[model samples]
Target chain A: MEVLDNKITKFREGLAKTNLSFREESLKYAEDTLTELDFPTTRVERWKYTRVAKIANTQFSSRKDVVKQLNLPIQDAYTVVLVNGYFDKELSSKNLPEGVEISATSQSANNLLGKVATIKNEVFTALNTLYATDGVSLRIKAKTIVDKPIQLVHVITGENTIATVRNVLVSERFSEAEVVQVFLSENANASFTNNVSEIIVEEGAKLVLDKLQNESESNFHYSNECVQQASNSNFKINTITLNGGLVRNDLTIDVDGENCETHLNGAYILKGKQHVDNHTVVNHLKPNCHSNEMYKGVMDDQSTGVFNGRILVSKDSQKIEAYQSNGNVLLSDSASINSKPELEIYADNVKCSHGSTTGQLDDEAIYYLRTRGISEKSAKALMVTAFISDVTKRMDNDKVVEYVHNQLHDRFGWDF
Target chain B: MIKITNLHASINGKEILKGLDLEVKAGEVHAIMGPNGAGKSTLASILAGREDYEVTEGSVDFDGVDLLALNTEDRAREGLFLAFQYPVEIPGVSNVNFLRTALNEIREYRGQEQIPAKDFLAMVKEKSKLVELDAGLASRAVNEGFSGGEKKRNEIFQMAMLEPKLAILDETDSGLDIDALRIVSNGVNALKSDNNATIVITHYQRLLDYIVPDFVHVLHDGKIVKTGPKELALELEEKGYDWLK
Candidate 1:
């Protein structure tokens, strides 16, 4: 067999020891789906700007090492720690709220673990489903408000290792909570991470999910998140991609009920031949729903960035309000960005608008600053900061805002 | 405090300032009056070391240094300030923060101590009051959402903070009402000192009523054809530039 097929055969042989009935069923479905789909290339419409040939040709194997002790994210809430995509129970928080449930993948008794994200057409997600051995299954019961933020920290520490994690989160009726998922690595290693998250927000529930991806620059990271919202429920996802070699995020949220709100905001900064892509889909399937998405990027020194926002308002979805915008700045002559904001509306009574803008710093504005005695360097930094201010203001958490702001400042050498 | 001789400049091969000569000493305010397209603002831009204009032939001396060779920020550091005809609106950058940064840049060039936060705040309060700028506007972004009159006042407010040796007000009185013009001119009169100079570029003599100029030069066809005292402004304001043409 070819190496690609051999990797699949090796993956199936490893998954032969699955014990859970639902997971075992999902593994079979994943195996069948993977056979039908291949890793996406640039020819595909949805991934026309991203190239994934290296990821497909690389020799990847599931690798793990028991980390006796590790430092978790500094947070005041329940912490779920994962090393090499396996849940480290000894390192996670033991004490929990009365209605909030957390468990390991092998011992999970939750029925909603693999029930949310059922889209099998995505190859990466199917690969994640077939190879993910352990992850977190969490749910908040009705009317339970978790004051502290539940943080899931994923650490990668190996070379040529492939780690896949599957996270399932279901917030019941009227429940409100905040969750922060972080990806971090200590060294520059050639690794691959395929993470899939399935989230469900039932009637009147509100959930705030934030993702911070700061992996090694030599690694490839891909995440596919699918969320479903019911009537009067709200879901918001804030993603900040700080540093990565080849990163692609595909987040889709289905607004399936009336009077629902969905928001997706992301910001990225890349330099030195780095590549980042952000693709978001906000689907309004019912009447009286609203969706908003904004993504901004700043690339320099031959780096590349792509932002594709697709807002789909179904035929039966009346009185829908949707807005999407993407703005990018290319600081170097060789740096480039491709931004496309697409809106597909079938509803007659919908108000939808989409726009995108890509350009360099305003020369007139730069000259204005220079006449004020500010150096050209400081002036450029200030203008770039101003360019991303609107997107940064969308972040709700102060700590996360400060963290992202400091990262951008430190990365762009705008610390002054 | 500044001298220019036989200054010739152009934009895209179209000459704007042709053989323009001017001289200003300490404690003097000179108003260069002209009609539209007479290159009045072009002269101001060139003096502040704007790059858009190609100085095919000319020279500018600021206090004794070759001002034509300095960069924009370097000219600003050496005490040349140009209040733009259309002040650029920069959102997300606070007015006070920009002023403080500009002040520190000038200070750093002079090898002076950076101002403390407490002193900076005090200076903001006092200088903004001098220009009659609202306390709220001082904390907001630089000229973002500001009215026409407020933007002109902000230009003067920056002038008050920086205390430039040669301040060129490009059309500072264009969009202001009579009352705004009076208040803005009052601020200019208050800042006038023996060691510093001001160049007021205007189209009307109404502003000359408040901040009286020592010399009034008429720039026609890229050259100053007439130079006189303050009364010359009234003559042109009544008869218009057609008489000179």
Candidate 2:
């Protein structure tokens, strides 16, 4: 307790040096939480494969007046940008679709702090809750569908900056919508990002969430996304992480009501010395729920990839069907991958299975293509594209799929 | 157009073809039938330039040039085609795309302009009918989930598309039913001309019944034991390989 108290005192002294707008009580809460809690280490079961202390030990500086100017090349959506964990009202507007409401919640908002108190055991969540200056709160009305997507851009700049952003989304009954959250950082500067996103879907609501992470080479990022679904709701999530320094993403979904359907799909492309870790958990709390998960990774150079997925079907969740798969391709000998796909089913009448495969490009397929007069380089490129096309084509969004394909081409130096 | 002088080949340091000699002229169909361990398929593999098989002592001449000097793709682009005994199943590669690539590669090797897409589609439609292959099947991954007869017909379809000078049908009749055999044989017959040659490697005389060979050679113990006219296939079928052995 004394060691933790000393650490908390040091952290508060460091926090006092930054000119952040926070209430004294919130600052006291942050210090109290830091003193009471211990940072997650390798000894923890969930954090066994990924070590976060490497970043926790580093000192990060917070900059005041570090404004960001974001110009999204992609159009046809409402854009919201956050600079250094602070929501920029000047750059972000409420030009949303009908029946949708978006607003910023400050630390003083009623019930906001208590709503996140349940997740205090999550160190990052507690930290973000205590220090989050401002966050976005979005709500969609019942029986209304939003045609265009809602885009949220989290931009981080300056060196040694530690930032946290929080988001909460609630979908009314039978509402259908899509949201895209993008995390971007400029250049190779040491930084840390801690983010928490919570989503809840009412009965019969359909929601699609796409998370894109494109961070700088010298940053450490940890994100937690929690989604809960009601009866007959449909939920789909597509995560794309490209070129990150040290990134860890935790996606936890609970089908709390009957007859719900969920799809979790992701693709990660890592190069250089980057390391990307994805941990996903899907719990079937009710009967007759279905879930599907597919994650693919392409690791090049000396990069590393880790995928840990778990599906749990409760005792009463009979007739629940869940499938999970993880596939990886290592382009260089120095590249590494650690994948674990697990299923725990307490229900007897459930069809649940999981599979994982890690290997190099198919040599026989490459040789077969080459024997047909195709060049060796072209053959390898075609095989690689075909291997990844299975996951990309499932997106069903032509533009997004094309963007991923182009990113793959840029990574492999292939024209198509 | 093709000559093999004392061609000796081995796989895994075990000799398969020892001092085998054969000549395939233009506008000819030759059938090489042999017992199981007679190195018949090995001869086709060596000719098509499979890397695992080493040519310890051999010289092959194709179109008045050294054939063994070229790599696998170069040999393929130089108008050589080998219909495998068991066609490899390439998942996620469309049959139409594979055929188009092979065709354009051969065209580029010959210094000819590429065939336009419209013409290529027209040619595919025309050749697909020759092998009785459904138009829908051509759009699927190559040889993936294909029936035995469909796989054989697809081989002929590819042969018609590539139109190589020397088409070696390695056991094209092994897995085919009567209907598939007729379609494959008819496709082969239609593709054969005075400018191109075919080498039909089979274990039975059934395939030769439809696409009759001009010459037949019985291979035994990695050497050509007997050379005769097409009627020799029927004779071997009647007496079986025991008499030849």
Superposed Cα deviation of residue A147, candidate 2 (Å): 1.9
| lDDT value, residue A81 of candidate 2 | 75
User: Clash pairs of candidate 2?
Assistant: A61-A160
Per residue, candidate 1 scores C-alpha lDDT tens digits across A4-119 of 44344444444423333355667677767777656666767887999876677677667666665543344577888888887887878999988899887657775665676676
Considering every candidate listed, which one attains the maximal DockQ?
1
Best of the candidates, TM-score: 1
| iRMS, model 1 (angstroms) | 1.1
Model 2 interface Cα RMSD in Å: 1.7
Under CAPRI classification, how is model 1 graded? medium
* Candidate 2 chain A worst ten-residue window by lDDT: A1-10
By lDDT, the best candidate is 1
Name the docking class for model 2.
acceptable
| TM-score for candidate 2, residues paired by index | 0.88
